[model samples]
Target: MLKTVSGTGLDNLWDDAKASGMTESDKLLYRSNLLGSDKRVTNYGGGNTSAKVMETDPLTGAEVEVLWVKGSGGDIGTIDKSGFATLYMEKLEALKGLYRGPEHEDEMVGYLPHCTYDLNPRAASIDTPLHAYVPKKHVDHVHPDAIIAIAASTNSKELTQKIFGDEIGWLPWKKPGYELGLWLEDFCRKNPEAKGVVLESHGLFTWADDAKECYELTLDTINRAIAWFEEQTEGVAPFGGAAHPTLPEAERRRVAAALMPAIRGMISEDSHKVGHFDDQDAVLDFVGATDMPRLAALGTSCPDHFLRTKIRPLVVDFDPANPDIDGTLDRLRGMIEDYRADYAAYYERCKHDDSPAMRDPNAVVYLVPGVGMITFAKDKATARISGEFYVNAINVMRGSDAVSEYQGLPEQEAFDIEYWLLEEAKLQRMPKPKSLAGRIAIVTGGAGGIGMATAERYLSEGACAVLADIDAEALGKAKEALVQRYGRDMVRSVEMNVTSEEAVAAAYADMAVEFGGVDIVVSNAGIASSAKVEDTTLELWNKNMSILSTGYFLVAREAFRVLKAQGIGGSMVFVASKNGLAASPGASAYCTAKASEIHLARCLALEGAPEGIRVNVVNPDAVLRGSKIWTGEWLDQRAATYGTDKEGLEEMYRDRSLLKRSVLPEDIAEACYFFAADTSAKSTGNILNVDAGNVQAFTR
Candidate 1:
């Protein structure tokens, strides 16, 4: 039943191909989308598609045959022509004659760029040559969980014969390179009737002259594997189960909500690195199975999975009722160390003198029974992507074991693929991530307005954004909104009263658990108050000072403590106000507290400079839209002071500024980003005004 996504109907597939105004690259995009749409076929960036098309070269203005293959930047489902890595097929083929063996492997990288007919910035996929070697005009190479389920099993040879018979050729594990191309080239010559080549412990390479047939070959092969799995496992429990039973869904989430942050803390090696906990059904089922420890030890679903997931998942046991967090966390730390030691031993066993230095011996995933599995990496982006890839692996391994024993590739084979030059080329093609890519940042009062904007900016620039506020309801709503846009991994929410030292400590501890450490802290939480000095009551004055002045001090103190503990220098931005630089009448409480907060930033900056922590302040005024302080009675009161209605006052305030523009939360966010990112590496003890050019509050 597995098939292409609903697009380009089969009956008209050739009709459209024959009578299409769409460019070849556009047609390939359409086909790639169809292939990538089904998660069963390819999830995330797991596949490559290509078309042999003739195009006028931009450089030489001559028509040339190029293989336009989907490269980096997206999964098959969402790729555009821009995702296609256009290469001259003739030039790509010319290098095939020069290959003697695997020695020319690394040199393939140097040759790819020169062979690229178009100077597209995106590098060709590591499997470019595999596409080039085949005689077909179109190719669909994807890792369908169903196909991998068969190919990754101990009985792979038997299953391969059962499913495809003489129609599909089989190759033992070979890392994608010049070597793989040679193997495929020779096999195609001998097995001319084959529809595809099943790469053992790898994936599928299916091709046809037409795009539709190539896609059908991939789907049809996977369907055959699925059919075999269905017929063989008629009465068998999904996989060997003791771990199959699960805690109540609610209880499981409760355990994850508590345990994941702690696990994240235990495994994190640096302030920039973080953890992502995934409790999807497949992950939970696999981790909860009784024989999970033994089954998981088999290894990654494939060699390429090792690039992100490492060789094997680290398994742990947990009691949902007595999740003895602190003790359990300590145990996790020891387990991670053991995992590292074991990896080093494995490296010692297989390592050659010329091998690249082993990647850090750390667990990318932890299979916990009650809490599901948690994936760790340097940043939220990597953590989530790795998380998805691991989920696919879990399904493949489970299906493989159900069919036969799960026989993973040897550890040395994984090492070869892990250190292959093509993966190095992929790494080389990766653009430098943003300065805050790995930093964990928290914005206090980030439920809405300037704080929320600042949190969003941090997430976009690759920092983990934790929204901290005193309002739990608001925090929950904000978390939902962010997760809808950025995913659950990059954003977190915690409720805290910044003025209460106990609350502040608890908040900081929560941060420690979630991200191992905190690097950038935005002290944005504050309460706005307006009254003449004589008219303000003692309680009102205390309240304003507690939130604006004392709150800033507490958050800054905790940030310093957390950063010092981690031994990683960080950045802190205090969201002061224009009133801090110039006082306003009938607003003594708000003005004075803000003034104190600015000075607090300067003092912190002076203290933090020696340790490389930068502290800066942004004076944001009249950012009335989306602000909790600017609504209802407060809005009426502020507008009354200007003798105008709310809308009139907004315009009046905007018109009065030197630039005659209203300050927005995003404007303040831009300044906060400057301080939070390394853009201000040399800047500290600084103040940037975000009040639309208010000269009266300008500071030298």
Candidate 2:
């Protein structure tokens, strides 16, 4: 049977979250408790809560500040201050102006680059803007069990109307982020006095002038709906009291970790914020009993909760002595494949656009005979919530049907919600391309390490790339490597200097003709000139900028023209250096050129917003393999200049960053691919620090 907490306990959490004396962490925990009070309330990292703090502007002497939102992948229950991503209200509002409608989202996001690099690379929640849109000091978004149950029902609209009345506005489920924010903005503006908004097939959103009010409102609203549900089905009894065997704790954790990534991808977030739950008694009882398959088929309480607890649970027969673990695993894999096939078929039937499909299942519940229940989430909070909801839903469903049976939103409806304009807006805002198939891309300095690695990365991801370098022999070698891997038809070789516009233009035109048109460009060519500011000369300055800055401009201009003419948006990646932000004693020109490239990316992002072209820069530090920059001789020389051994120099660099390690070419390539792929479609104008952790000069 589903468990219910006292109304007073839920109310207390609201008061606690609103109290001023509590630390930020305490407030977050308090908010989480309030959000998690009901079984249908929240699952793992499926929900978020925020409190806005007003601070005095040091410059203006007026109270103006930022909204400290839950960082990307943060679970509402356990998130602390460190889990919150701060955004200047003004800047967030400014982002709103970038897109006028759904069509322009790709262009707008392409122009507004990621502002800083100090925070985690995991993106801020798509609902960041929505929380900001709420005029209240506190805001929350959750995949409440009751709410999802209500939404998924065929009579959802009618039931919601009967329960919440006209005060609750409804928006069709849309992808999160800018698109959802825009929709919510419009909804709020139109409704003017709505208490909350419920997204069909999605979840719930509530806000209040204070944290307490928001929490209380959420509780009251959900409870009222529950009351109505009880009235409608008064005779229904809780089901499934049969027990199942349990698994070892260590084994369970291992399986759970392996399962999280798939779940996280399903929910469109990282698994780091997921909560975990493992109760051997519950698992054993649930899985060991008869009709385990029937119990596992009920859908999640909410769509967001899918990541923590997959659409269905897994029932395993436990036998420690004659353990058929391998056989069991194989069966599980087969089941997963069946689930995916079904999901794909549903998507095909419901999809409106050509958006790529998601292959990961959101959550998985484990049922071991004689064991309690074991639930996995990216974090502890998520896991706990999943367990709570699972226990409740199983009880409810089993009672209703003798065997638990639940229905999901129609495949078409689910697909529509999953691919809603608002959600797509968030996705579109990513600073990458939607598809690189049949697109032409050029990699400057392509004969060298980072450049060659990036070129290969692009090829692997399905783009026809041309490798250009000043050295014909090296270009040929690089071309051979790529051709050997992807075939000659996919790669081209050219000898050119990035600094020369004629060379850049000719290469771009030739490649465009060969591949039909240019769509992606990576400005990865440049030389490092190390000299102190006092020892730097105009010649040194000009030499560095000529290749790094001017080369990028030439390539960008050519790409812009092609993309504009094609009337399709494209992406440009400029490879900058960690020195662009941090200071090093004897590298004036290198630093200056890299910094210039960063600014150039910003300017290009803004300029290309209207043309459906996006420009961004990747600042990488200590990239080792396939780069001339991290060569042993090069490191030795740099180490000598710093009056230290090569090992010492490496250590110094590594120790400077939070994640103390050398950045790999593949790492930069991954970041580059992120910008170049459809995943970052809405993002433009952002600068990604592919460095392991070095530059810590600014905070935003």
Write down the TM-score of every candidate: 0.80, 0.45
Candidate 1, which segments miss by more than 4 Å at Cα?
1-24, 54-65, 72-74, 118-122, 243-245, 257-259, 262-271, 320-322, 447-449, 467-519, 532-585, 588-700
* Backbone atom clashes (below 3 Å) for every candidate: 4, 65
lDDT of 2 at 460: 80
Candidate maximizing lDDT = 1
TM-score of 1: 0.80
- Candidate 2: list runs displaced more than 4 Å: 1-11, 14-40, 58-62, 103-123, 238-298, 311-363, 366-700
Which stretch of 10 consecutive residues in model 1 shows the poorest summed lDDT? 4-13
Model 1: lDDT to the true structure: 0.79
On the 0 to 100 scale, the lDDT of residue 294 in model 2 is 61
